[model samples]
Every structure is written in structure tokens, then in C-alpha cells.
Target: MKKLLIPFKISLLTVLFCVCLTNAGQRRLGTSAANGLVIQQIILKGKVLSAVNNEPLAGATVRTEIASIKTDQKGNFTVITKKNKGTFTVTYLGYQTKEIQHDISTSQYYTIKLDPQQNTLDETVVIAYGQTTKRFNTGSVGRVTAAEISRQSVANPIAALQGRISGVEITQQSGRTGANFNVLIRGRSSIANGNEPLYLIDGVPWLSAGISKASSVGSQSPFNSINPSDIESVEVLKDADATAIFGSRGANGVILISTKKGKQGKTEVGLNAYTGISQVGHTMPLMNTQEYIEMRAQAFVNDKISPTSVNAPDLTLYDQQRYTNWKKNLIGNTAHLSDLQLNLSGGSDKTQFRISGAYRMEENVYPGDEADKRASAQLNLDHRSENEKFRISFTSSFSDYKNNILPTDLTEGIYTAPNLLPYEDNGSLSWSENGSAVYNNPLAATLRSYRTKTQNLVSNLNANYSITKHIAIRLNAGYTTIATDEANVYPLSSFIPNNSRISGESTFANSDFNSWIVEPQLTYNRSFGDHKLEMLLGSSWQEEKSSGRVIFAVRLQTKLDTLG
Candidate 1:
């Protein structure tokens, strides 16, 4: 019995020694008891860049014919490929295909550079609001470069987007000064709800003017006062995937405007200028001298009045020379436009800044009217700590608009009273000795309408900090304010003949809004031989408040812009 027990004890000791030796060997292989890293997969991480500029090109496609993946929004791609031997292809439209051998253990993720394959129509379009690789994008996104608008001499940004995109439609409301046009991304989706796409300028939302459709002309809100000249690119986000981030506001898609910002280089200055003429596309068909006479004769017959009852006995002379030419006389020749812009951008790793200013003046298609001027100034600054863990940026802008009264008045007058005719006698505007409602003149109403002036100020700050390799925090706050003053005059003809003959009304309104956005996120990443596991947890909150006040002053003594 003693011998048998001795043998069993020896066997147990032998097994324990072998177990310790195996663990030591495994330690040398750089693995724990669980063998977490020995799986048949691994992670690949790298950037896809432009061959010509070496800039990160977002939306490049990376895949093995059997397996596929896409780059992140920042032009970086991370994928888990099988450990088996195979080839991976990186291809982008307008760029040559790049192929490399894949080995999870020995090869690093590729930093692929694609050369321009100009022959094929394979080009990846980077939309402003969001990005999509041409291969996977199911919806249409329109791309318009800054150069195109500069060539067309477009004064408004939305005007530049027209004709360039297939589905977008633009309608000019009133050719009124300070009239920023409206854009429909795909088509009208709602009957009452506002379908205008949300506008995002350089990552921050450029909130709408907040004037609900319920606001009338006298109470209309000013257009968003951003300068089109400072934009680097405009991308119309057209699909559900592109706009889902904005949720409610994105029901109509979004318009993303990326402003020119400083790069890591020396300060550079760019100047742009252009001039053009705009002519009336069409004229309203109105009475010539003969038509005016005939129409007046018919009116006399319709009203059962005798030719002798007319105040001016020489009705023939009035019809031959004066009243018929009133339409032509009130209108003018082609309108003219001129625009000038200047920009400066540059900075180092620690500090960067961009500054720009632009001025524009134009006479619209409508006669008797012109836009005196529109101007904007913008500035942006960014600073980063040496380690790049913390970054802060400030952006501020100012805009002013001056709208003249003439053209707006003509448009309103013609459309509002198409039947009103000026009585002409001896080639001069004829006023009835005794004012008659039938001969009511619209010129006085045109002369007394409102002139609008507006000023806007916008500023924002953004900061981000990196806690570790895979975790970060960000905070942003912004403020926007707009002040507008308008003066409108309605002469005797506009109101009841005896109602406020010196008729005029002036209104002043101002709106102020403030918003804050805060977000904190944690990212976790691990790597097997050919598999990558990444996890992200994040939360974001935003709050906004707006207030406005309006005042009206009536009884202006003069037709000028100045108040009584």
C-alpha cells in the first residue's frame, strides 16, 4: 500500500510541473489564459487620400470583391478582414484603383492614395451636409463649386444652386430688395409646414429667420444674413439618410455651406470681382395710345357718361400722347450689378484664422427700383494645444442690407392694379380736377411704399478635448441677432381719398436668439489578428431661445426714407 501511494503522488507532481511550463510558454507568446488575440480576424485602420493633393478624401470605397466596407466621415477607414490570404481594393470615382495584399499579422492597414483616372466618369461627389461614396449612395446629391457661382455673378447663394441641381427648384418672391430667394430641395412635401431645407454653415446650424408664414409683409422677418462670397462649397443634402441627423428640422433635407477656413500654411489673399447687366425678360401687354382712347370711350359708354361730361375736353390728345405711354415711361432699361470680395486665410498648428469681406450692388429686373448695397464681414480663429488633445475655435460674422424702393413698387403696382390707367393730357400725368375713384392713380402708392434696412450679427465658439486615444468631449455655444427697420408710405390713392393723405407707415422689429450644444462621447477599440471591434457611446443636448419686438409709426410727411 505504501508503494502504490508513492507512485500516485509522483504522478500528481509531474502534472503540476507540466502545467506551469505550458503557462510560461504561453506568456512568451503574449497571450492571457483566455487567448483573446488568437482569433482568425484583425482590424485595419488607415486613411484614403488624394493622390494629387495628399488631402484626405472622404467617401473612397474599400473592399474585397467578396467583402466590403466604407471610410468614415473623416476619410479614415477601419475594417475587419479574414486572416486568410487575399487582396483588398481601394477605388474611388475619378481615381485609379489601388490593390494591395492583405496579411493580418505582418501587414499594416493601407494608407491608400488613388491617382486620377480621368478617363472614366467614376467620381466621388462630396456633399456639403453629409458625405456618400458614389458606389453606395442611393439618393441624389447636387454638387456646386464656388467657382460656378462666381462665374454667373450670382448675388444670392440660392440663385447659384439653381440650374446646377436636377431636382431643386427656386422661386423669387417679389424681386424686393433684401429678397433672398427660397429653395425646394426635391419638391414641396407639405402644404402648410415650411419645407425649406435646414441650412448648416460650417458645421453649426444657421437657423432660419424664424418668421413663420403667418407673418405678413409689414411684419416679414429678414432673410438669413450670411454672405455667399465666403463660401467654399455648397452641398444640398437630398435623401433621408443625409438629413436624419437633424430629425424634425431635416424633413426637407438640408443645405450645407462650408465656409473658407485657414489651412496649415502661410497667409494667402484672394480677390474676386464681377459685373453684369439684367434686362426685363417680359413686359405686360398694355394699351397703346389708340387702345387707351378706345378703352376710355368704352368706359364712358359703360358708365353712361357723355363725352362732354369728361373734365378734359381734348380726350383725343390725352389718348394720342399721354396715358398710353405711362407703362413704358414708368419702367426703365436693363439693370446692372457689381460684386467685389476679398479673403485672407492662414495659420500654424497652434493657431489659424480666416477673414473675409464682400460688397454687392444690383438693379433687379423690375424697373424704377434698385438694390443699393449688401455687405458682409466674417472672421474665424482656431487654437490647439501642443499635444492636440484640446482645441478651441471662435467664429463671428456681420451683415448689412439696404433695399431701395423703386423696383419693388413697380412690381406691386402692376400686379395689384393691372386695370388702373393713367389719364394723359398734353404729355403729362393728368389728375382729375375732382378726384374720381375710377381714375385713381397708382404712382402715388408706388412712391410712398416702404424701404427696408437690416443689420445682423452672429458669433459662436467651439471647443473639443481628447481624454485618451479613444475618448473625447466637445462643447459649443452661439448667438445670433437681427435688427430691421422699414418705412412705408401710402398716399391718398392707396387709402380712402380722405384717409391720411400724407399716408405713410414705418415699422421696426428686432429678433435675438441664443443656443448651446454640448456632447460627451466615449470610444473603445480593440484588435484581433484580422478583426477590429469598436464601440462608441455618446449623448448630445441643445437648447435655443428667441425673442422679438416690433413697433409701428404712422403719418410720415415725406416720401423719403427718413421718418417724420
Candidate 2:
């Protein structure tokens, strides 16, 4: 063993010395290879132009299957890929994208153009329970395509639809973790209860409207928990003519979500992954230690009270130490998030299937905070006859979420007047011990936060039986269930020290929501040259039920009692 060790150490030192010398030589040469091997290489050349105007379109994107680049001043970009035998997709915002297959080694340059989308005379729109041509439809309708859904980083499906079109509003209550996200479409049309839009997935009514938000004070919605990556397209039904079928929830607008399905093709796999960091971009200013202490001292002198009267050892000392920079500790500076998705889709003329799975992890910028994680699975299957007149399809999904974090408000209280330290030995206040005033340590509280886990299962089935060449009747049914268990532990130190400090609150909250809906519709289609006519009428029944319970330990023996 000693002989082996001696040779290993000598070999390691020799390799390190060589590496150092190699690095030094590279630095001196600036752009020279240590050996004959060419290590780094970049081949960049491409052209992007507007198909409509035939002019160069700068800032366009040229993306290969695994790499991407943005066009520069001359509307050209260069991306590196192995073998150069793949397809390149060029895209520009507000324009139709183009994809071309070519051998890269043969042609390192490209002249790519993106065409402007042309709106046809007759556009089909999905209404309350069916689809109709926009020109002939007398109702109000809004449609969002798959391309639009891919443009933004949305936390929920609804957020994907917000602000992209007119007459839609989304409001986030606060910047706290698991904050409430409220969405109102076409303004508020109801006086009592909620004015949230009704949701439909694939043609069957879904029960997301009943999902409430998280609230520190009251009940709120968790609509933002829905993953946007799972959606293919969204259609909103706005006016009475478009919403009459959903009379009960029609006061608000209706949003229809369609999940991706398999198309007729060979089995293929698609993967998408993105990782990024986020942080609080801004914050309100608050007084620091010296400013706080000085301001309090002045306030006392102005109020004609003895500044000495504020001498609470624990409160004063803690306030002095904590007030140094409360905001820094209160707000999380940086957070990381990563999402991965895998999809397999394929089908023949008669049958098709799609399966997809995704995992996401998000770390809050705040310290001692537990990261949030979610996993989702989806499956879609469709079958059609050779005549293409009859088709049947099924979709299913499952998802789970886990989150743990503390409230930010509690962090700010450490320096508040309630816990302000008044007594000072020389320039610093004296620290307090066991009998100190009750105030949560921001960092401790953040680290000691609670945990919540939720799981959801969904299934949808639909079929289209064409009665004629241009006429058909469709039937669809869907079921969705969500089960959530959230637990919170409030440590004794978070409360006033005393019997109250001995009191602890540890509660487990769980709820289950289920919804089932079925719809049958008849449609007629005809086209006379440029003129087209299509109609549909359908009815559906949807039911949703949910219940929850919370258990807590009201008795606490010490500040650490809730730790368990």
C-alpha cells in the first residue's frame, strides 16, 4: 500500500504541474492550443428575413434540435451542432415560424424567412360546448393557440392566458410564497360569491373554479398551481351567446383548455427543460438600527415621555441587533427553478397515443425555506376509422406538489417597536435571556416553517361519431380529483413567552375535490366556395365536491415543543 501511495502521489503532482504550465502557456498565448489538437471551434452563419416584406428580420431566432441562436444586425446567427444533419427551425414573434431540413456540413449558411399570419375570412372558434365558425357565430369568443402558450413563463395555466389578449385581468395578492392569484375575465359580472371564469378541458366542463386561493386572513384560490406546460391551447367564451350553455357559472367568462394529443406519425420523443434563477427585484425601504433607535428616541422626547422608560433588556438589545438590516434578512435575494419534461407520441392511421411526464423544482430566495417540487404524468389515446368520420379519444393526468416555507411578515416584526430594545450599555443594548419579550427570530422562523403536499388525478374521455360527410355528433365525459394534505407547525417562540409560549399549533389540513362532466353535441358543416357554415349545440352536467380538516396541538411546554 505504501509503495502504491508513493507512486500515486508523485503521478498526481506531475499532472498538476503539467496542468499549471499548460494553463500558463494558454494565458500567455491568449489564443493558442497547447498541443496540435484544435479544442474550441465555432461556425456561425445564417440569414433570417421576413417572408412578407422580403427584408432582413433582425433578432429572429434560429434553433436546431438541441441548440439556439438569435439573429444579429444582419439577421444571421450561428449555432454549433454535431454532424450538421438536422432540421433548423426559425421563428419571429408575431410571425409564422418556418422549419427546414438540410445537411449542415454542405450548407453552413441559410436564408430563412418567417411569414406573417394571414387571417382567413372564416375562422373557427370554440364556444361554450362546441366549435363554430367565427364569421357566422353571433356569440363572443376568444382563442389562444399552442404557439401563444409557449411564449411566457407562466406559473399556472390561467397566467398563460392573462394579458395576452384583451379583457382579461390577473392580480397577485402579495409576493409571499404560495400567494393568492386572482383572475377575472371580462370584468366582474357578479355581486356575491366569486366572479372567476368557468374552465373546460377538451369539451368537458372542469371544476377548477371551486378551487380556493391561499390566504393568510381568509380563503383564497390555488389556481396558479396548475402547470402551464400541460396545456396545448385555450379558448375563452365571453358573451352571453357563448356562455349560455353554462348558465350556472356563465356570469363569468369560460376558459377551455386542451391538452396535447397524439397525431398520426411514427413514435417520437420530445423533451423540454429550462433552469433559471429569480430574486426579489424591489423592496420597500425601512429604518435601520441607528435610524430606528434615533427616531424612537426623538419620538419619546417629543411625546414628553422619559426615553429611559423604554429600557426593556431583551426588547432593546434584540431591536438594536435585528434593526441593523431587517430587510436583508426578510427578503430572499435569489431563488432557483428547474423544470424537465418528456413526451412520447406516435400513431398510425387508425390509432394514436401520447404519454408525457414532467418534474419541477423551485427554491425560494428566502433562507431556511424548503424548495417546492411538483411531478406530473399525462397520457392521451385516440382512435379513428379509415373513413375518418368516426373517432374516439381519452386523456388522463396525475400530479403532486410539495412546498415548505415561512411567512415574511414575521421576519419584519423582530425590529418592530413591539420588540424594540430600549436599554443600552454604552452604545449597544444589553442582550436578554429566557425572560426576553416574545419575538420570532426571522431566520429561525423561516427555517422552522411548515410543509404541504398535494396530489391530483384526472381522466377525460370523448368520442366523435360523424353522422354524415360534413355533419357529426360528439360525446365527451371527464373526471378530475385532487387530494391535498397541508400541515403547519407554529413554534412557541413565535408567540409571547409564557403559557402562550407553551401553546403550540400543529395542524394537518386535507381536502378532496372531484368533478365529472359529460357533453353531447351535434354539428353541421358546409362550404360554398369561400363561404362556410358550421353549427354546434351541446349540453353537459358538472359536479364538484370538496372537504378539509385541520388538527393542531394547542398545548406547548416550550418554544421547541412544535419542533416535533
Candidate 3:
């Protein structure tokens, strides 16, 4: 029994010794493996600049496996990583991202020049409801940047788009100042109704149709009220996919106009002024005195009319060697245009603002009191909370325009006989008492007064609240008001004995239009694995009201004429 106990004790002690030895070996192996997993950390310094211009890019992101940093205003960045050799990435807006694999132990300083992506595929375009990149957009959309719009000397904003956009045809109906233009996208869609595309300014519908009830001497476009200098970009939606979001209003297509906004930068002030001259491209030469006389003689012989007939002009008066070129006399040779604009813009991280004022004047080619004068002002503001969870923006514009129009049809002046004189030796309008058909004095139309004044105010407010990282609530409200006043005064001298309807007639019209809109929407965006899901649920309410009155009085009852 004593011998068996001794053997059992020896076996137990041996087992314990073997266990201790195994634990020591395992601990040493664990320590070595832990040491192998440790990595050597190093400090890296870098700078980012634009490859095209070599301009320092501030706020550029530099990321590595264990460290991330942004460049300062001087485009200098510093980062510490756990690897001596690893790839680092640099990213910036409007620039191509770059990646560099380096051994920090060998080189701690790096100068990265990021190339600019000028390809249109990466450009961002404005769409119906939001903005999208050209690469991901599946719709047919045309974009006209501010640079393109300002490349030409254009009085109307729509005219600037002529010959610039595909599938768009712009035709000027007349050469007169403030004349209407026909803009057709994808051709005419409706024969019974208007084919004009819907116009939106900063996501708010604008009144493209003339709201005035006054009688106009020629066609006028409501777009004239908006100053072209205030526009930043114009986007035209042509295909069904591009216009579908607008629903029924998009049936005729859509034009989205974006105005200038403040950017996050230092305060900037800009002034622009330009003056130009306009003249008729071509002129028709009228017949001289000798030519007129010969033509009249030939006409009489062809008609078999006796030269002594009453219908024939008196030989003594017609024989006078005098001639007048009515075309040159009525339409003049040159017109003048001038524009001046002043703008101020600036912003910080949390707030931004822009203010602009402009004045434009255009003189008529027909001389006299025919001209168009306009004044406009715009204000835009934006604010964001510290965490960017709450954001609000406001935009407003005001415009006042006055147009002095020709009182008579200029076409009639073009066809006036070369032998006829507009004024007599007594400084009064000339007239003939002959039984032959008589024509009104062409000069009277130039002297008669017809004027139109339009005033418009457009304003919009937008607010957004981020309920979560993937969900947001937004509200938009807008209001627009337009008022027009028109007047026409015909003096007694403009009247003809045969035409009694023009006896000192005066006409006046006043109109007012107001519109308001409210929209509330909730947006949800999330990603599952490699797929992304997005949704927009919204509702909109809009209201418009218009009121107008017109009055016409023949002859003045009192010295003072008032509109009722």
C-alpha cells in the first residue's frame, strides 16, 4: 500500500509540473503574437491644390486608415496613422478625388494636385423638383448657364436663348422695343390654346401671360418685367420624362429659371454698365420727284384716265420738284440702349445674403417720346442651424417698368406717298379737302401719347427640418402681385374731318393680379446594402385672384381727365 501511494504522489507531481511548463510556453507564444500584431505609427503632412490653376483648395478632406483631417485655409493638412505604408485619399468638391500609396517612413510631406472634372457627365443640372447629376439623369434636359446668357447683348431674357438650345425655336414677332417673342420647345403642341411653356423662378410659378387688360399697340411679353441680369441659369425640359413631374402644367414643357444666390465666401460687390447703339439693318429707297412724276403719268395712261380728271393730282401742285422719304423720316436711323447693375453678395457657414439693383433704358427707333425704362431689385437670404438640422431661405424681387408706345400703326407710315408732306408751311399738320380718299397725318401718331406702367413683386420662403438623418420635412410658400396702368390720349389735332371717332379720345385701364402658393412635403431616403430607396410625399395648395377695370371717354368733360 505504501509503495502504491508513493507512485500516485509522484505521478500527480509530474502532471502538475507538466501543466506549469505548458502554461509558460503558451504565455510566451501569446506575447510574441501580440508583439507581431502591433504596427508602427507615423505622422504625415500634405497640401492640396487645383491641378488646372494650382490654387490652394481649402477644406479638402484627407483620410487614411486610422486618421482623418481637413486642409486649412492655406491648404495644409497633417495626420497620424498606424501604418508606415498605406493608401490615403483626398476629396474636394468640383474636383476629382485622388489616392496615394506612400511609405510615411521614407516621405512625410506630400503635395497633391487634384484635377478638375470638366466633363459634362459630372455636371449638375437643375430639374423639375430638385437637382441631379448629368450622369444619373435619364431625362432630356437643356441647360443654359449665366455665362451663355450674358454672352450676347439681349434685351429680353428669352431672346438670349435663341440659337443656343436644341429643340428650342425663338422668333421675334417684331423689331419694336419690348416686343413679344415666340418660344417653342418641341414645336407647337396646341393649336387652340397657347403653346407657351410654363415659367418658374426659383421653384415658384411666374405669370408668363400678360395680366394687363389694357389695349396694346403691339404685342408685349410679361417676361420683360424680369431683369435678365438677375438670372443665374435657365433650364428647359423637353422630353416627357423631364416634364412629367409638373403634371398638366408640364404638358407644354417647362422653363426653370434660377436666380443668383449668395455663396459661402467673402463679401463681394460687383458693378456692370454697358451702352450700345441699334440701327436698322436695311432701308428701302423711295422714288425721287422725277421718278414719281413719270410713274403717275404712266399710271394715268394705263388706267385710261384723263389728266384733267379730279381724281388726278393738280398738275401745278404735283409738278413741284419736292420729295420726301417717309421711311427714314418715321423710323429714324439709330436707337440707344443702356443698362446698369449693382450687386452685393456674401455669406458665412450659418448665414448668407445677396442684394441687387438694376436700371435699364431703351429708346425707340421711331424717335419722339417712344422709350422703355425699367428698374428692378432683388434680395435673397439663407440661414442654417448649428447642426444643420433646421434651415430657412427667403427670396424676393421687385420690378417697375414703363413703356411709351407709338400711338399709330407704323406700317401705315411706311406706305405713305412720297409726294405728300406731313407738315405745312404754317407749322400745322397738312390736309387736303379734295373728294379723293384722305389719310391722317403720319406725324400726329408720333406726337400722340400712349403709355403703360407695370409693377410686380415676387417673394418666396422655404423652410426645412431634418427629423432624422434619413428623413426630412419641408415647407414652401410663395406670393406674387402684379399691377398695370395704361393710358392713351389723342389730341384734337390728331383727328381728321372724315374720321370723327378720333376727336380727343382718352382711354385708361387698371389691373391687378395676385397669386399665392403653399406646399408641405416629407422626404425619406435610406440605403439597404447596395441599393438606395427614396420617396417624396407632398401636397400643394394655390390661389390666384385678378381684378381689372377699363374706361374710354370721347372728348374731355372737364379740364382734368380722371379714370374711374
Candidate 4:
């Protein structure tokens, strides 16, 4: 056994020695082969330009299998590759991405022109948690651009979206200014759940479009605080794709609003002003005074009842010769709407800024001096580090809005008695005939108004850092607060004196909604030949605190009512 083991060990040592010699020779041979097989590489110089204007497309991405780079301000790029023939992929925002193959060994200089994307399907759309083109989006998305919105004479941006999107219903809840809106995507989602879609302003959640439903008529829309002219685009994300990103909040859908930002151009100032009048159209066809009286007499005759002061006041007690057009006097006034805006914007490609202020006012058709007035200001600041890897953007909007209008709709006034006057000889609301309670004063509701004042602030900050060519980190932080002070008043003059001692009262409500959110995300993107891959890992943290109070008082002076 010892002799056999010694022979086996010697055989193993000899095998190992021979293997070492063979590996050394192979290494030497590989070195010589590599030196001889080395390919001669050439540098390619190119320029990327716009096909329409021939303008230089700065920061355009130029990529090849061997090398990749971005164009300089003059749209020039250099690529070094060993292949004598290869393809180059050129891409820029708002332009069609193209791949052009060239003979690199024959020509060192090439000019590539990219055409602007003309199809709406190719236009980029901002979506939930990300952005993509409609042609490539996996979910249903509807987009409205700033140009389309600017052409519309609308006070709320949501109104401009009407009739523009498919399967989306946008309706005004009330005719009054600052009234809430109802938006449904693809009809109702559930039988007993809130159907309002989640709204995001610059990626920050908008808790609600209004503060509270304290008004007896309709809820005021907080969307009014966001000026329509200041918006750059509005994107609606619909279906399960949206719910996956926002959980149940986006069960109905998602709305993304991106405000305007400054561009790289000469400093410019713009002023916009518009004034118009609106009146109720097409009054209901109704019987005149003679027709109404005749109909009433015939009805009494058919019922075998005699007309009395208590039963037929229109025939016995009130003035028989007096005839009033109830609809005209109640809602015949023309409403005046006016808007004035001033904006200043200018900056370089690295940093840009835009600031604007606007004033808007809209009067109601009611008899009183009731109107909705809003003053708003917006600011947008954007910056990019010299390396173009670290980028930061800040957007903020502020507005002070006041609504002085009736709490409930005055449609009831249109069907009032056609022969009765709205006012008495003493210039007061007519409610009594011969010192007796007989009828109601439709104009009285106008005296009892619902007044509200709201101050809204929405601000956001976004930052992104590139960890590598295919990996990036992004942080989104935002803060928003809405302060609303609303009042519902009922003066004794607005009500009839019943039971000899009736009183009037008022209700005051104040609310504050404050919230903040922070989100950090890590993303990876890489292209492998014809296929592309992307990955994202993110976390979101949000906090909110709210408080409100309501108070009731009797005989409060309307002029002295102040929430401040």
C-alpha cells in the first residue's frame, strides 16, 4: 500500500507541473493574439438639429453601441467606436427618436436632423408615478395643454377639460362662481363610495377642492385658487394603473396639474385682460297675469269653491290691476366678469424663473351687490447643477378669494306668483297684505347671504440626483395649507315676523387644513439591445393636521362680521 500511494502522489505532482506550463504558454499566446487583433477606432463628430427650423438641439442624447454622449450648446457631439459601420440613436424631448446608421470608416462628420413629433399619440403625457407617451402608455390617460386652456374663457381649469376627454364627465354643480364641480371618469365606480378622483398638483396630493360644505347652497371650489392661465398641462390617469400607484385614493382616477415654468429665451413681460357679461338665457314659457287669473278662476269654479281673501288672495286681497314679471325681476340682472393678469419670465437653460399676478371678479345676477373676487400670485423657480445630474425645482401658488353670494340657488323665485310685486311702496320686501302675513319675499334670500374668505398656499420642491448612468435617486417634498372662513347669515329682515317675536341669526365657520409629504425613490433604467428594462423602489411619508370651529350668533352686525 505504501508503494502504491507514493507512485500516485508523484503522478499527481507531474500532472500539476504540466498544467502550469500549458497555462503559461496559453497566456503568452493570448497576449500576442490580442495585440495583433486590436481594431483601429475612429472618432465621429456630429451635430443634431431640428428638421423644421434647423436649430441646434442642445442637450440632445446621442448614443451608440460603443459610446454615448450629449450634445453641447452648439449641438455638437463626439463618438469613438471601432466598428466601421454602426447605428446611432438620437433622442430629444418633443422630437421623434431616430436611429441612423452610417459608415464610420468613410465619414468622420455627420449631421442628423430630428423631426418634431406631430401625432398626438406620440406626445408625452404625465401619469401617475411616472410619465410616458400616449402611444406607449399602458393605462388610459387624457391630456390638455396650456395652449388649449388659454384659449378658453373659463374661471376654473376643470371647466376647460369638459368635452375634451373621452369617457370623462365634467359638470358644474352650480351656476354660481366658485361653485364645486363633479368629475367622473368612465362613469361611477361604486354604489356607496366617494367618486372624486385624486388630484395632484406638481406631484403633491390635493386633499380636496374645497374646505368644507358649510354652505346650504353648494360647496365652494378651492380649485379657484389655482389660476387657469398659470397651468402648463393637465393629465388624467384612469383605470387600475392609477390605483396601483395611489392605492385607494386613486380608485376613481388621478389628475395631475403642472404649472408653467420659464424657458430659455429673452426676458419678456405679458399682460392679459378680459371683461365680459353673462345673463340667464331662455326663460320658461309661463302664463301671463290674465292667463293665470283666468286659470285660477276656472279651477275655483270647477271645485265649487268661492274665492276668498284667505283662499284666493290673488283674486280678492292683492291689487288686481298690478301685474309683475316675476322671472325678470328676480333673475334678470347681467353678471359682469373681469380678469387682469401680469407676468414676467426670463432665464437661461440652467436656471429659470416665472412670476405672475392676477385679479379676477365675477358678479352674480342677484339684486344685491354680490360677487366673487379672487387675487392670486404664482412663482416658479428651476435650477440645474453644472453637471446636469443634480436638478431642483420649486413651485408655489397663493391666492386670496372671497365669495359674497346667496347660500342657496334662487331658482324658486322664478315660479313665484306672476301678479304680485316684489317690493312694497316703502321700498321694502313685500310680505304682508293689510298688516297680515300673506306671502313670502323671494328677494329676502338675497339679503341672507353666504360669505366666505379663503387663503390657500400650495408649494412643492423636487430634487433628483444621478447615482450612475443608469441609476438615479429622486426626492419629492411638498407642503400645503388651506384656511377658510365662511359665514351663513339670516337677518330678521330676511324672514317674516311670525308669532309676534321672531329672531334672525348667523353661523360662522372657520377651518384650517395643513399637510406635508416627503417621498424618496431609487430608479434604474437600462437598454439591452432591442429590449429595455426599468426598476423603481420608493417610499412615501405624509402627515396632516386639521382643525375647525363653528359658532352661531343672533343679531350680529353684517358689516362687523370679521373672522380675522
Candidate 1 lDDT over 128-162, as tens digits, reads: 32344555566666767777766666556777777
Among the numbered candidates, top lDDT falls to: 4
* Residue 317 in candidate 2, Cα distance off native in Å: 6.2
TM-score of each: 0.64, 0.69, 0.76, 0.77
Q: Which of 2 and 4 is the better model by TM-score?
A: 4
Give the 10-residue window scoring lowest on summed lDDT in candidate 1.
212-221
lDDT of 4 by residue, 1-564 (tens): 998999999999999999788766655443213454744555778999999999999999988776789999999998766567877799999899999888954787989999998888878898866778877888888889999999998888999999999989998888777788889998998877778888889988886555654674678887977799999999988887678868988888988999999877789999999999988898779887888889999999999999987888887776666778766776778899999999999999899999999999999886667888999999999999999999999999999999887757787778776777678888888886754346887878877868899898999999999989999999999999999998898888888756543569888999998989999999999999988898889999999898999898874334344432
Residue 295, model 2, lDDT: 79
Question: What's the candidate order when arranged by decreasing lDDT?
Answer: 4, 3, 2, 1
Candidate 1, residue 123: how far the Cα is off, in Å: 7.6
Ranking by TM-score: 4, 3, 2, 1
lDDT of 3 by residue, 212-262 (tens): 355564566777889888899999998875556678788878898988888
Error of 2 at 6 (Å): 99
Best by TM-score: 4
Can you tell me which runs of candidate 1 are displaced by over 4 Å?
1-140, 209-224, 282-287, 291-323, 364-370, 384-391, 406-409, 412-430, 433-438, 468-470, 491-496, 499-508, 519-537, 553-564
Model 1: residue 195 alpha-carbon error in angstroms: 2.3
What residue pairs clash in candidate 2, if any at all? Answer: 212-220, 212-221, 213-220, 213-221, 315-420, 315-421, 316-421, 316-422, 502-556
lDDT, candidate 2, 1-564, per-residue tens = 998899999999999999889876664543335367544323537788887788888888887655788888888787755334667788888789898776745876778778887554365676665566766678667777777777776555666666776887877655555555666778887778888777767765555443322324212235434567778778777788545666766668888887888988999999999999887676666666666667777776788866432353432344455533445545555788888889999989899999999888887766654677788888999999888888889999888877665534444543544344323456322234344634433444553456667777778888898888888999888887777766667665444345444555666677778778777788888999998777777776768777777565576365476566
Q: What's the lDDT for residue 353 in model 2?
A: 93
In terms of lDDT, the poorest run of 10 residues in model 2 is: 211-220
Q: How high is the lDDT of residue 234 in model 2?
A: 83
Question: Which ranges of candidate 4 are over 4 A from the true structure?
Answer: 1-114, 302-304, 434-437, 555-564
